[model samples]
Target: MSEAVARHWRSGHVDVEFLPVGAGSYHWRASTPKRPPLFVTVDDLDRKPFLGADADTVYARLRSALETARALRQSGMEFVVAPIEGRDGNVLSRIGRRYALAVYPYLGEPRAFGNALTAEERVALKAMLVRLHAAPKAVASLPRSVPAEVPFRRELELALDSVNTAWEDDQYSRAARPLLAANAAAIRGWLERFDELVRISSADNVDVVITHGEPHSGNIVRSGTHFALVDWDTVGLAPRERDLWLVGGGEPQLCELYRLRWRLDDLSSSVRVLLSPHDPDGDPERALRVLRISIEREPFTRD
Candidate 1:
């Protein structure tokens, strides 16, 4: 935990202690006087092997993530726990070199909202999505540090690039490549049909909110009947569907409810098969696709 804090910022500050709160990457619990204690989970950019194709890419991603979250905070999106200057509010902090930390007000351990979430809990999640996808303020420009959403694409792109370089050869080609290829082909078809999807998404009247970029249940905290989202690292401009994609995938009934309530034509099956958490074989194919498409897609959208 201390190591995690050291990754983004200098560990010199007192009163800021990091406790282990979860698994896979840099998850933690932090505390300070200004804000209540809170739990946080972040992708570790400091892992020895590194998260990107090269050290340079990893640095780019980490720096950009910090800058982007800071930018989002400027736009009034507070659902995310960010790492920025000052210990102000419930946001995370960025100190030292790459260490980014935040205090969440300590709402207890993280838990799934579960299958039987009350209407209010569901509404909270949806409302959180609304806040996330709300239009960026006029001056909320994107960071030039790391790849943007279009450049980042989906997560699959990482796998593709790694395999191409043989860095991800052992696990990728043997397990994940084929599934990703099929999904990639499907998404290409979907892109050709993107206009239709966009029309449906628009007509659905659902808020095209900017999102946490990655809003798996793991990033959510539930207390009684209420739920709150954390982790601002992946925040970006996107459809509300981005938030629901994983939620619906986890609960088929919720996906159905989403379809009926929002009138979505079809959610991406590729997103499902590729991003599934329970994918035992590992989602190599989708990873490759994400890296590929990220590079192929334009850098950012023009208003």
Candidate 2:
């Protein structure tokens, strides 16, 4: 038994104890003076994990995130409540078979964004973003994480091919084709002007700040005075613009207003690339190409 593994299974850092949860991730039982027992999750320790990627890579990236969070914690910024590694809340702990452990401050009454954040809360959200992006060296010193950036057109094309040639899910095949056909011109235009789009998207490239790669309203938690960001697992380096993209992309009405909040002067015409049908017979290569394009969109964002 590795010492690290033994320590994690027996008793976790501080008083928090861990329990294993299956699936590419694990969970732990933890408590703090101010909060009661709660569960925190860590990614799986497999050599190759989700989406057919190396598990070690993901593990390392997550560890790096914890380190970054710790450094950020020291800077008087507290948007994210990251898990501390060891007893002293300094070192991150590696846990069971292939998992890691961290303690989350349990919410007495966890408030979801839709319920908690009103129109005013949206202002608070943007303010939190500004503070998060302005963390100076905190995010800079951390690793860069980017989604694969294959051109949206290429991805759609491949996805179309998959629909035609492969045994894919019928629903995805049917829905995506018409969507692509209708949006082909817009999609191709965005692709042809990719660089221009990037430039325009990044006009307010105020800072390449740390961000939660998967930023949906789901990841936010509401506390008394301020909102706390949970799930730092997807933390990575990204253009500050990305912090606002999902909000606008998911909700178009907010596009113009969200841009102003993030201080972006222009909004790049957006396109959602349907890489490949996620069917039983789908080609992974098509998915990979789409992944590459997603990565290319923002060169500096990496994990």
Candidate 3:
């Protein structure tokens, strides 16, 4: 076990044995003698730097997660794996200014979405989202300051420029260069359509709600026969469509439950996928193949 994990476990006052597991961030399955096993995730501040330069942001995110979890539990949803407070009563324990450790009671292996979800599972997921959107005000108020709203035209322009620069400057590996070059035109066309869709959605005043940000299959876990949502780091107030898009968009069942009238164009989602930065650590060949399929398979239309 690393020093940070040791320090955090000691501070939490839990006699647990840490077993290292997983890729991406450092994760451990913490087994204790008297208490239930816990899942501990440690983010290296120097590497991720998601909190920016402010320690306050970290505190706010932790508090927001705890508040959201409590609200969900009180609402009779016991699946959210809320953060466990350390001995110092803080969800986030700063370890030597290099790592932040947050702990939660363990949930078993995450349900893989490699295959299509069952109809019953989809219904359950939709119900969970509805309850989450209706969480109490105290939970909604805990997120960090809302980001300034920027026009989609400006945002797309900036992203287009950045993507072009990355390709032209050879910022990515040689294997990725050919793929990016081949799809440049398709990528740009998609962005233009996306910008227009955003304009329409904004003018229509789409409903906003506290969202899980990314509720895709990987983030949803199975606890016994029930399901739970994990990774509250990106939890915040945003367009209800953000989460809906990830879950099935405009499906009659979801629309009836959420009472959503406006349907986001498919291109709107494609733009998001295209704008996402390439993973620095991912396999270049596989990443390129995925990118090509994502752009070419979608019909590029303009208004």
Candidate 4:
């Protein structure tokens, strides 16, 4: 990994240290004598979020997404902490067939996931999101648009339908089948409500903009005087609510629509992981926990 960074970034004698931080991706902090310290991110393109996308396809879209972010940052949007381009000018570099790499200026300011947002932070984040929503470059450059339906929705349906059958794929899949069966009815109702929300929101003319799809505290940080956002991997052209719902200050119905969108995305992805063969590096257990909570928790219940 250090060799790859040095080769691509043209930095000599990189010192790479693994940082176990984000879910579904590998991170490292790399330093060199010639340039400032950099943050490195590597992802397995064949799993979870990129399951259906082959390496080349995911690479193209991710490169475009990060480029959009770079454009936003260059536009003087201080909150956009975009990717640092490689020597070849592409935003991402292929790491064999299964993985890809990207680099960024190391912020070294990671906020803990699930930490409660203070009132001041909430206000600042809301204002930052408002500025992001109005940026025209995001709409013009985004390669992928936020889908109206929850991600992994089809896989979730298949899991629910196959819950009664024995899953011989693996121990985790076998265990997951029964658990899914127990909550099949409630899960179906949740999907129906999600679709209903989609119908209602679709009828209203909501402005679509570049969204930092997961703008939770873990992704937003205080950069000097401004609150900057990181993790531009999920950036896309979407409704303002796609980002706003998490931060509050939006309409109750719209916020609830997206809040449900978030959970359903979580539940569906977890179910898909358990139903199929997946990476076991703490992912299966995490998926199981998300599946368990998602099924038991009532819809519209705030955490």
What TM-score would each prediction reach against the true structure? 0.47, 0.60, 0.69, 0.88
Which number leads on TM-score? 4
Per-residue lDDT tens digits of candidate 3, residues 1-303?
Answer: 444444655434444444454333567777645667778887665433233445555545655655666565655767566777666666677666566678777886544433445666567677788878777776666555332122233433444445445432333334344555566576566555544554555544555567775565666677888888787775667566556754656433332222211111222222333444363543444434444445554331110
- Candidate 2 TM-score, C-alpha based: 0.60
lDDT of candidate 1 over 1-303, digit per residue (tens): 545444443244324444454433454566544555545545444431213555455555555656667666567665555554533332344445444444334567665321344455556767776655554655234533121112223443454334334333354344445544545654455344443444455454443445565455556666446566665555544454555654443233323332222211112222333444346633546544543443343321100
| Tens digits of per-residue lDDT for model 2, 180-250 | 45545654454445534444445453345676554455566666777766666656665655566543322
Is candidate 2 or 3 superior in lDDT?
Answer: 3
User: Which number leads on lDDT?
Assistant: 4
Better of 1 and 2 by lDDT: 2
lDDT minimum window of 10 residues, candidate 1: 261-270
RMSD of each: 10.2, 8.6, 6.6, 2.8
What are the lDDT scores of the predictions, listed in order?
0.45, 0.49, 0.54, 0.77
User: What's the lDDT for candidate 2?
Assistant: 0.49
142 Cα displacement, candidate 4 (Å): 3.8
- Candidate 3 weakest lDDT stretch, 10 residues: 258-267
Clashes of each: 30, 24, 0, 0
